[model samples]
Target chain A: MISDSPLLKLALTFGALSLVSVGGAPAMMPEIHRLSVEVNPWLSNAGFARDFALSQTAPGPNFMMISLVGWRVAGFAGLMAATLAAIIPSSIIALIVGRLYMRFSSQAWFPVVKDALPPIVLGLIVASGVVTAQAAVSDTLGFAIVIMSTTIVALTRQNPLVAIATGAIIGLAAGRLGYL
Target chain B: MEQSADSSKTASGRPLGKLELFTGFAEMGLFGFGGVATIARHIIVDKRRWMSEHDYAAVLGLGQILPGGNIINMTVMLGDRFHGPLGSIIALSGLMIMPIVILLGLTLVYDAYAANPDVRAATIGAGAAAAGLVIGMGLKMGRALRLHPIHLGFAVTTFVAMGVLRLPFIATIIVLAPLCIAATWWMRKR
Candidate 1:
């Protein structure tokens, strides 16, 4: 009775995150990872990793991972809760500040905040990469795929989906070969 | 961007309304693969002319450093610009319609076949690649920014706090954000 239901957890988690997701929702991925996989233990490493992959692979903003996580945890209700919670709070703030932003973009403080945030966001993004990698890699072949995929996508202008689809084929081959 | 003195207006120089916002954003939601930034710019500035290049840049620039997803913020801001509070709702609904539907469709398929061994293996593989994709994306951004020394210091600190030490995001960001902003202000003054 003390523990909250998964649906409640989904709402609470995303609602809180939506406000602080300053660097963007993807920047919140590490926190999401920690809560769902480590602290509260709602999803397994593989489950979270799969959801991250699907969310990224799907044709939408990077923020859609909330929907995938919700669906995995509690079906339709979870999906609605997580998506609405993740989106609404921040949208409200944006609505309030947006008018000011357009009018005052050239104001003294605007550029400083803009310049300052990127490095921090970049760091969070790197942390997210690390967290997702931990969830995804269970063996040498899997590890190798991550490294190679990172190299190819980072060094070139190639689309990221190339790396994803290639990894699937490699994994299928490796899995059949019993390497994984 | 060399875009000169153009006033903010749609392509036909007519005022934009909720209908335009909905359809425009719906198009972005449907085809904005990998991300929506590029597609959003193309649609708003080029195809729809809802906003000139200069105006789009100003709003989207502000959108980037603010909270939430960049496109979501852009839509909210742009919706308000074109209409009002209600425009925000319409534009957001436009953006989510196709994405939510497609995401749910994918979810159903995933649930139906997830128990299969082949599917499991592929999912694992795809997940690994996704992890790499994320890392690669971070690296790409790092390259683009050419990190100032101050910026690099903060980036390294943030990375260690989250990735190495596994500190909670809320407290760490609260502590670091002001420090980083102050450092930037100092640098700008110099």
Candidate 2:
């Protein structure tokens, strides 16, 4: 029996996460991993990892993983609830504050706030990278793939999807060769 | 205000109608694999000429400071800029609709292949690459900022607090963001 309560909880949790998802969805990964895996037991670590990969591969916002988690927990209704929860609150704030910022484009505090945010956003992103790498990298081959993909994506204009797809093909070949 | 200037320019030029906004974002949603920011800029600034380069950057800057997904916020702001409240709704929904359906389909496919060893291995590989993507994005953004010492310190501190120590996310931000903001203001003075 799928209870309304868990779905509601899912909505509430993601709704709160929506407000703090600075820099984008990836910034919230560590917390999202902890909450869904440790706090709620809604997903195992591996399950969370797989869903994270799915979200990454999909052509949308990285935060779409939250919806996947909700779906895993409670099906379609959970999906809708979590997706809306993840998008709505912060969007409302964006709409309101965005309008105001346009009006106050020359305010003294605006540029200061903007300049200060990038570093912090960078930090959060790095933290998310750490959390995700810990969860995702399991073997030597996986580590190598991470290093290669990171190098290629950072140093060149190569499409990231190509890198990701290459990683997948390598994994498939490795699995067939009994590397796993 | 720069917003008024951009708005007036948009008004004078061929303004984006609701359907165009929807179709444009829908296309972005479908093909914008990895990150949507570049593709969005291409569509909005280059292909469509809906916004000038400066206007696009300014809007993107504002989007970054606010909460939620940056692209999602971009959709809202861009939508509102052209079409008011209804425009915002249409743009956001367009951005989400196709991706949501496709993701749901992918999830179902993943569940069906969950037990396969090959599929599991490929997922692991994909996951590693995904992590790389995140790290690369951080490095790229950090380089772009040309971070001063203070900013670098704050960024490293944040990484330590959350990545190393595994502190709570919201609490760390609450404690650190104000300090960083003040430091930036002080740096500006000098």
Candidate 3:
């Protein structure tokens, strides 16, 4: 059998993710979750979910999931390569543009870049919401939770953590009762 | 920004040490799960207190508008805040390491049990929670936009057009953006 390098795979997945991860890491959720669970079978859906949760609960950006995906594929080496792959491309661009941005603070193009971005980002973020919803909400109880959460989110100004904790508790209780 | 120079100064005016960056990312990496934005918000405003809340909102708005990732923009901005170019690099590394490590572990378990039923159920549950989180975020963004009634009308219209009508991405951007901009310009003029 030919030796498959998980490290290389991890690098490639995130490298592509870097380029196509428009709007942010969550925007790529549908694709990345599909790739990780369905296409490559590198990580189980549950495992991916847990890793994602961990990534979310932690600090920093959403792109941290790439590291977990990479690490799952090939141990420590995979972890470094994936994290590097996920961050380096954007870092380089930001670094270069940051320098230029500082220099061109007074230029017209800066505002143009600014003006052109909001709608696109809005659309992408909306798409991300759809994609994440598709992967996450499954059963009746789960579906209700999603709708309730969405409604509460829209209607109330309560902190999101309270809502999340509430849903988690409900879900956990439902699981204990075999109602899920 | 108005803080005295001595308040921010350490032993020297040097950038953050490698250790600081590493530990910072690790803490965030380990605990920054759930909605990544919340973690991101904490880093920008609470932990580092780099930018004021208003500035954070402005930058976040701009980041959301641009292509690439919103969190990445925050990372860059925060990096710029703490240590300029070098600081940004450290910050990004600090944020990314933990997730990758976790993902790698998932890959191994996935390879072993791709068809497991319990795993499928867990994924489904998690996905629901994610939806809830997204809804929460959308509400937050909507509130922040503070559009006038007319602009809010546009936002709702646009949301329905894109969300329910399933318009193409470019189509939505092309159609709604100019209208919003024109409306905003007109509103400001009056």
Candidate 4:
């Protein structure tokens, strides 16, 4: 069962993921979902969505969600495995990039990669939104919350915490009213 | 770039003590709720004057292009600038330790209350709402960049490939990254 050991799996999955996590954690959400939800039955889609929502309510780095995935799979040790695996490789690259960034930025190829990365990352993000929504939404109310929250956050300069908190309050009220 | 980091040192800047760096980053990490960067900007630029505003902006820009979490990269660069690799490690640990511990604590509480219906309802609602935040974040990033037709095409393609098609993300990115970069190169040349 060494092949199936959750700790090893967490280490491998996140270790590789840290490197490709361009544009930070949100950009990798699509891939994160694919692996954590589908590739491994570590958590259901709704559970994944809930975990993400939960992370937002807490304070930490954007990558904190990965810890939840690890925790679900293998508890405290799993969490450590995932978090360390996620941070170490990427941080090393970051250290190297920090050293070379100025040198690289002036080069011609730099602009191309710079120009290319944002859009793809954006696409991944929007895709993550859709995937999360599909899992979390179960009714018209849930659908409306996503639509409204998206519009409010995108159009206005409101803090995201406001939207999330408001959503939680609405959900509580809706639950009381038997609409949830 | 090194020159700027070197030259712009405030009286309090340059070789910022290991203790100061650790405590500073620890505070940043602990309070980093929605975004760590804003707090970082506050502490680094306004509060401590560790880096000038312009310098902070430059580091942030570099942080974005780097391969890790933008804030994480920012910490590394700033730490390295101040105290080299040792500083980098200290800053990172200081920034992460409390947050990681707190996240673990939250997970413990959530696990304890897993069967609670009220918690379930609210979490689901919150999840639904947070989905919008993700999409909106993408839109905000899009607004920041000048969108070419090529960028749009690739964005849509990547979205469909991953979100709709549910292709393996690692493989999808592998195939797409080079192709997208190359396509970008071709477009630029044309």
Q: TM-score: which candidate is best?
A: 2
Off by over 4 Å in 4: B1-14
True A-B contacts kept by model 1: 0.72
lDDT by residue (B1-190, candidate 4, tens digit) is 3456454345455557889899999999899887687788899888888887887776777777767788988888888877777878999999988887887787779778867877777777889999988888777777877688888888899899988998877777788878888999999899
Please rank every candidate by lDDT, starting with the best: 2, 1, 4, 3
Candidate 1 chain A, run of 10 with poorest lDDT:
A97-106
Q: Note the chain A TM-score of all models in turn.
A: 0.93, 0.93, 0.82, 0.94
Q: Which 10 consecutive residues of model 3 chain B have the lowest summed lDDT?
A: B1-10
Better of 1 and 2 by TM-score: 2
Score every model by TM-score. Answer: 0.94, 0.95, 0.67, 0.92
True contacts kept of each: 0.72, 0.74, 0.30, 0.71
- DockQ by candidate, in order: 0.62, 0.71, 0.27, 0.67
Candidate 2 residues B1-190, lDDT tens each? 2355458345238767889999999988888888677788888888878888887888888888888878899899889888887888999889888888989999899889978999988888888888888888788778888999989999999999988898888899889999999999999989
- CAPRI grade, predicted model 4: medium
- Candidates in order have lDDT scores of 0.84, 0.85, 0.60, 0.83
Tens-digit lDDT track of model 3 for B98-168: 65555545555655664565544444454466566665666656566554577566656655664556554
Worst 10 residues of 4 chain B by lDDT: B1-10
Query: Which residue runs does candidate 1 get wrong by more than 4 Å?
Result: A1-5, B1-12
> Which 10 residues in a row give candidate 2 chain B its minimum summed lDDT?
B1-10
